[model samples]
Target: MTVPRAWWARLPDPVIDAVVVAVAVVDVLLSLVDASPVEQAMAALACAALVVRRRFPLPVFLLTLPAIMQAIVVAPFAALYTLAARSRDRRLLVACVIMFALASEASWLLNDLTSDDRTWTLVNFFYALAAVAVPVLLGQLVQARRDLARRLVEIEEAREHERLLHSQAVLTRERAQLAREMHDVVSHQVSLIAIQAGALQVAATDPDFKEGACTIRSLSVDTLDELRHMVTLLRASGGRASELTPQPTLADLHRLVTTSGIDAELTGELPPGTSTTAQRAVYRTVQEALTNVRKHAPGATATVRLWHADDGAAFGVTVTNTPPTRPSLPLPGAQQGLIGLRERAELLGGTFESGATAEGGYEAILRIPAGTD
Candidate 1:
């Protein structure tokens, strides 16, 4: 069988009360040589109230203040202890002032009946003041410490909230960037697929129609593989802890132009890592330009020029296509392609401009800071 411990053993309230009562009994016994048993009994009651000082401070102060006037040895100190332990609210302060006034007056009155020396009365008055003020001062210090702790906790919580908001903003921007890349890669490939499929369908009665179909299937498989690789790279590198494979840089512009229907010309030194941003930007720019060409400039040849300067400090891309022989077809409304390219350029603190050239050709120029990569 398990035995339970006494509640007072854990709390120590009972032991504290016992000690206070013992001291009060001893003080009462010493005062008995001059005072009555009734006076001693009142002092004992006041000392006992000290045990519950923290719980019922005001009541203890009121009960003990009058008793200390008759038996000054034990009751006054116990009342001072209670006053010190209680909070410095209006009620507690008021009670302490009243008790101090009463105790001072009582000391003067008692000393008048005994030896009436001015110096001795002054000494007793100082002791009475010290007893009352010390406890209240200690309580104020404790309250100040608690207030400081609360402020520290609030500051920590505010910093945590700010960190969370910053992280969320970064994640939101990264996801938007990823969506734009995926759109550029997939849309450009799909446009080529549509063109090849159309060509195969038109030549269905021709002898080489089966070979064109086979080429379309092969291109489709290659497009899917590139899409999967890009997706894996984007997702893996998105996290801080994940290691990612090297991605295609500006060096891969030749492959990008060849894959798309545009003929590209490189003029200056292309910087490293600018390829990812440049590729996405140039790809989307050409993709949109080609789309406009097919819709508005059929049979027009598109020319692309990529240049890097400032020792790879900056890079620029230009894609131009002549106007079609036939009348212009009505184009679709503004969509993700142009908007995504503009966003990508803005992200790198770059500029994107698309308009009609003097010779009836549509042109797009993207100038980006290579150091941004």
Candidate 2:
């Protein structure tokens, strides 16, 4: 059953109790006109007990029995309804119904034990029993309705969680498809360009033409290398290890520096037992810094320093390049690599810094917490 959001439904517990007690008091006043002094007092007591019916439903129902005998039924019916609504025992409710019916006819039974009208009294007792069942059924209906409402809320929340997971799965699949397209189409085209450049470099007679062809081939090859790494990252399945290949670390740094096409020196070493994550961060920092040196400062000489600082509390890498000996060509770049390096360092509870040195050189540094693993 749907719950009401009406003003009365939202009323506070104390206000609801007060309204019920007021109705019961009016009921007692109406019944007491023809009742004896003791019956009147019992009816008042029953009306007062309605205020606590929610907290002590069974005991309050018992207190209203005397009022039932006195023909003050409003309070007794209210108490019975409260007991049925709050209780989970069907057998207990059935017993309470029988008890209420008997209490309503107790005076008749005691005063006319040998009367000829006992058969008619029996009919009246059955009638009262049937009437008492109305409140009990209504109370049980309300209780079931409340339980169903709670179940609906839980079902809605579960559906929302499932929808979120579904959206994430769809997004992951799209990224994987895009990565495949880049590797198949884009990388293939770049590879063709590089092959053509190599052929031209070998066949050209002019010295300047051969140098130009070599530069084109070099640029195309570098583009392919960067694309391969990008595609691999896009296709990663969010596991502890890559499904396709291993990521770069300090072990790969020597090869990176040597093939970077710049005059650079590798020096110093990180302490043993350094984490793979930190090693990757250090590697990327050096890689990005050197790429910057090559793009913006041609013919520059660089130094790569890997160090353990603060008595092994931290470990980091530093790359510094001297001023360019030759002017650099205008290269298209968005500076996204530096941003990525900074974000990676932050993930490992570390820091990344890059700036121009006083001697007209550029410097980049990455420091990671030692506990990062």
Q: Using lDDT, give the best candidate's number.
A: 2
lDDT of each: 0.65, 0.87
**For residues 1-373, what per-residue lDDT tens digits would candidate 1 score against the true structure?**
2235567536677777777668877776676677677776677677777777778877777767766676454555655555554454757675676567556667565655545566666677667666666656766665565554544554455468669979976985696478457757774676578577766766687658766776776777677667767766665655433244344445555665566544434444446565465666665666666655554564577777777785767787788887654333344466566677788789879988888889987888888886665
Whole-model alpha-carbon lDDT for candidate 1: 0.65
How high a TM-score does candidate 1 get? 0.44
Residue 204 lDDT in model 1? 80
> Taking the tens digit of each residue's C-alpha lDDT, what string does model 2 give over 1-373?
3456889879999998898898888888887787778888888889889999999999999999988887888899999999999898899999999999999889888884655579878998999999999999999998887655654654455458669878878877787788889999999999999999999999999999999999999999999999998888887752224547588888999999999888999999998998888888888888889878866786789999999885778889989999986534455678899999999999999999999999999999898878898
